[model samples]
Target: DRVRIFSRRLTDVTDSIPEMVDYAKTKVKASEFLIEGEVIALGEGGKPVPFQDLMRRFRRVHGVEDMVEKIPLRLYLFDVLQCDGKTLIDLPYTERWEILASLAPTESLAPRIMTRDPKVVNDFMQAALKEGHEGLMAKSLTSDYAPGARGKKWFKIKPSDRLDVVIVAADWGSGRRVGWLSNYHLAVRDDTTGEYLVVGKTFKGLTDAEFDMITKRLQELKIRESKWTVHVKPEIVVEVAHNEIQKSPRYKSGFALRFARIAKFRDDKTPEEADTIQRLRKLYEKQFENKGRLLKEVP
Candidate 1:
């Protein structure tokens, strides 16, 4: 039996994760089945690894077995849309969960609880964080699976890691942001070399007013400029929030910040007082105390 795993935009990524396909073929009871689930890379003691590890595993085309042995995967099925050639999308969330439970092994199902108590929800959220998960998804029991529409049927609750980084450069903006250096190049300092290592970039979490103000300050601190990007003196510091730090060859520091955005300006701190590359490295290394070498594909 053949199974297909389509990800965002319905892209066929089946070959990238043959292990999941194999599990679905042998473990899942349905002849024709469609399920919605989360697949995270597993680390030591079966704790979840950083999201970057999962991403690298998803991109493998060759040497997949090596990667698989390094970073095994675990799936948590939460919904089922089809089973045995019958459609189940019309079913409510709770009903679909029941169907999924019957088809998937108990250990393959997501940790489930039915409760309206805020204290219970809060405690569950804390537990998810402790398990190295981003957060929890709260789905309405009566709602149907509405594909491609993120309208209130489920709510995602996540907490981000924040760091104070300096702007080393900025690119010119287009469209409505034209005439403003809206996109920022964010970086952290290497204490040993006194160099600024770029971690990521973003044009988010800032208002037009704030953008205008920062543009003026950055232009004043400008040390050099090119056609599209203006390299600055790294004097302007700001607090930045991101989902995770990934091992990346794109930067000299071999680190990239995922989904980075400006949180707020840090006028109270000087560039010299900003967070350092060593701090980012510590967080990256902590993503796998014993498993990153085995599981993480360096990219």
Candidate 2:
């Protein structure tokens, strides 16, 4: 069933250039179809531009025409939400994918491949990484499109360079951060023993507003407090970035992060969903293996 394809602009739902939306509308040969996809800004080298660069495009309202010329945007259509006057939300994703392929330009749509082989999947992941994609999303063919919902049926597999840890304790701020939590003690789960082991501490990469909000939230979950540190129940999950994992005798799991810093708060994730000590061990081992020898000296 073929119909006119018309894409509606969603400024609030996604951070995309308005010009890109207008361009999509112009490319629609059909007048009564709706497709869902991500809008990405492309660089001169035909690779994705940095996200901050795309944000710059979104903020410019006065000289949008010039900005659009400098930073081009592309849409990768993935699903069909509507066709003619009928809604396709109830249909399974595999069916909607077929409809999207039939209507959208082949060059504009993301490729869909079905496979169960892990080796093939690893090859695809490497290819996507080489092409500068964050990662690839794995979806169940039988799943339905759940709008505004995060479901386990979809998985995002990326490079194992980041870890999501939970905040177990925090220290009272001293200088500019006075009256707020300054240092956060992060922990990863020890699945075998069912315990959360403190790995490292960080107070970086958070805005003033985030510090204030987290202070209040942590206070709510606080169980014990001393003059400087307040021990709280594991509630807040945060993504942490580190140069490498090193052996540590100070903390459990016998590991620590080198130059650890807070990447972002994982509000969508819970403490139980945080990364595990086993995963950390695996990453540490992989790092050494990549270097062709084990790191005997720990930083």
How does each model score on lDDT? 0.86, 0.75
- For residues 1-299, could you state the per-residue lDDT of candidate 2 as single tens digits? 22232223435522236554565567655568767777666664566644445556666656666666677776788877788788998898889888887787788888557899999999898786666565788888988878766398887776646799999999999899999997999899988887999988888889999999999999999999999999999989999987557667789668877667888889999788999998888886665332222112111
**Stretches of model 1 off by over 4 angstroms after superposition:** 84-87, 287-299
Which candidate leads the pack in TM-score? 1
Model 1: how large is the Cα RMSD against the reference? 2.6
lDDT, residue 87, candidate 1: 89
